[model samples]
Target: MAESVKAPKTVKVASTAGSAAGSGAAKAASKKKVKGGVINVAVMTLAAGLIATMAIPAYAFNPQGADAAQFKASAIDGMKKAQSQSVEVPETVAASAVARDAASATTEEQLAAAKAAEAARQRAAVSLASYASSYSGPSVSDFLANPPYPNFSLDQVFSVAQQYIGTPYVFGGSTPAGFDCSGYIMFVYAQFGISLPHSVSGQAALGKRISIEDAVPGDVVIMPGHDGFYAGNGNIMDAPDTGRSISIRPIWTSNYYIVRLGI
Candidate 1:
């Protein structure tokens, strides 16, 4: 009598269907959580991309290009201010920079000019020193300064030569106030428009070469005793040798000659 128990087939089928529905609900919930995790990752990625976009501009404008970055920032600020106030900014800023550059250039040019002037002064001093060294020794106007006679005329020069009778003898004198042997002759004849050599032997070689026999009143007379203008009285006035004054002396050497100073 105890073995007659039987289960309902519809009730068993309903329990299996109910278990399957519960499993499906659990799978759906897991899929939704996974999808939500993916969405959060994508949001983080978007946020990171946005941060990179902003940081790249900041890195490019770092210390290496600080001046240019500051200028750009100022320009943007200026433009913004200008837009707010309806004014101009580019021309005023550009003009200020140009003025500063011009002032710096002018100062540099002034310094260069001063240096050039100093260089020119040094060159002028050197040239003047060179000129003083080339002309040395007594001049040739000694004998012509004082003629021995009152009747001597410079031949062909059409002029009477007489000056400096008692001038003191000096070592290198060329003035009427004092006379050197060659310098006295040089000083006297220069007043009469005569260009004579500064040396004794050199003066005797001027004009047409002539012998003592052809000597005249205005003839240049040379002798070993001394050179002078020959007076008809046979005496000559000459700035004599060192420690001696100009005097008239007889021509005694074989080196005596007469030189015509002009044609």
Candidate 2:
């Protein structure tokens, strides 16, 4: 019985030893497989990096060649030449500019004309202001001889008339103080021993009727209710109105007739 038990125990121990040896051999084989897989992964990664490097475009990896630089310079020069080309102005735009210049010139001319007109007005006002209550002009005979009138014999009448140029206007008074239209004429002519009326109608009826074309200085110019001594051309030396004075200005009426005192 003792021998039988001992033999069974020895057999069981041998079986366990054989199982432990087989497990150790399996573990060693698994470690070798894992090492081989790591080496394979490393090789695959290196190959992928090499492929990525080769995938980059060749131009990006290299400098520009001489042909590319020459082409770029040629394109830049062509652009510069095109930029330097002269641009044409539109016809409408050019015409508009010309019109503006003409308008400016017209404005300047108008300004000049207005200034000249103002100057003329000032001169006329100055001339009007120069007269006073007591003024004597040039010698009447000398002034009248310039045009050689046919009435040269009436030199005393003209001289007396001119001396009263600045006399004030009055209703009917006929003195050196003041005189009316007909009063002025009657007074001036009376100084030379000539008889005249103080009425324009009476004076007009007494003189010899003559055409204005044949009238001379010292002739009588008769209108509707007015009369004056003819100075020359269309001017008269007369006391024009009540508030105004005697003046040697242009005649006021176109419906006037000429007459001579026959002196």
Tens digits of per-residue lDDT, candidate 2, 54-78, equal 8644434345654464445544475
TM-score of each: 0.37, 0.42
- Computed on alpha carbons, the lDDT of every model, listed in order, comes to 0.61, 0.73
Error of 2 at 245 (Å): 0.6
Give the lDDT of residue 39 in candidate 1.
100
lDDT of 1: 0.61
Off by over 4 Å in 1: 1-161, 224-226
CA shift at 187, candidate 1, in angstroms?
1.6
Lowest summed lDDT over 10 consecutive residues: which window, candidate 1? 152-161
